[model samples]
Target: MRSLVLCLLTVVAFGSCLKLPSSFKKCDRKRTDFNQCLSDAIYGALKILDKPLPSHGLPSLYDIEFPDEVATIGNRTYGLLQTYYRPRCIGLSKPENINAKLEFGPLTSTLTIEATYSQLTVETGFEAQGTIVLLPVNVVTPFEYTLVNPTYTFTFELEEYEKGTTYFRVIDSKLDMQAHGLKLDYKQLFSNKILNDEFNSAMNVKWREIFALSKSIDEDVFAPLFGTIVNGFLKRVPVADLFDG
Candidate 1:
């Protein structure tokens, strides 16, 4: 009877010693274990950025917008341009990926991806209304721009923070994407191919400015849309599901 009491006391004492601190207790698993699992899950999730993209057709993300802007028209000169683009439907498909890499870095719980997409197909119908100045004249323009096959490359960064019990919110995220061979078929408000050609030639002279705008669109527009998709998926799956049993 005495030996039985002693054994019971020992078991109780050992269990008590295993008790975690208050902060750690709040989580579904030990902090280290949870972090490891989350890292692996994050790596897997980032790779989906390269996967076959489905048509995203609802919510505001499906509708892409480009606002009024001004850019250099040519060397040593600036052009004033105003643009409004509203997409009725937009979707991405055909992921031909050359390579992709995902890294879960320790600092700030950051997830970084450096990926290259060989080709992609973008389907869209958007009202594009814009007027751009070359030097002495404003070129009036309005069109329905639709596209087919496009190619892309991207660099991405996202930060993760715990929302509650095994769920996380990714914030302050940014994504940069570049497009190539994207042909926009235009159904214009007015037919003036020669004037449009002149505008295009002027824009080509200031290619650097257009390039900067592309990066801005990626950061200011596409980043949040991508976060919604990624973080929404993360919230659905439990932290336990991230681990290898």
Candidate 2:
């Protein structure tokens, strides 16, 4: 670990003897200059993140349509539900409190990163028109909702191996849901207004559950996406290319 950290600081050939300019515009993947190139890229990315976000910021839109769905929460079961979600906006602020450590070895490389998000928002239209059997009364309704104030400590480990050609892989990932001041405004289309208000109030009371659900969803969705994106980018591109190019 110590050697890995040291390797990031100085290129082997230039150690204690060379000082490059603060800004290095180009990174050619040369074994002799690998470390410096990696350093320049990493710090440069951080510097870019530190800059103010554009007025539009980053927004992601997703449309989820389910013809039939089934969910068994504890003992209750919701079956044969037609659900749809059109996420109008899913946005996040630039990462804050970025902390990263890298380990480069003879055959493999690993990077662990930790960061926080100051704000995140999601505006969506959701409707699940279905029947939830509850022994005495069967509830059927179309639900719609929105959320905000998403904050969390995101951490992950990325590993790369050089058996034949270096490639990236997501070894592990976790989300620490520090604070999610989630405010949910939801309604059941067929249900009475008073009943919807009561249900929404009850839902708001389960903030912890919301955090837990978000974490689970993040793992299922984002984790695999990261693996795909990273590995795809590094698939044929050798780790050496980052430094040698």
lDDT of each: 0.41, 0.45
- TM-score of every prediction relative to native: 0.48, 0.51
lDDT of 2 by residue, 71-165 (tens): 22322244434333433323332444455445665545555444444554444345443444442333444444333444443344557665444
List ranges where model 2 is wrong by over 4 Å: 1-89, 105-108, 122-167, 171-174, 187-198, 241-245
Stretches of model 1 off by over 4 angstroms after superposition:
1-81, 87-91, 98-108, 120-165, 179-190, 197-209
Residue-pair clash count for candidate 1: 0
lDDT, residue 144, candidate 1: 34
Residues 174-225 of candidate 1: C-alpha lDDT, one tens digit per residue:
7655654333333343257775565555655554565555546535655565
Best by TM-score: 2
True lDDT of residue 166, candidate 2: 48
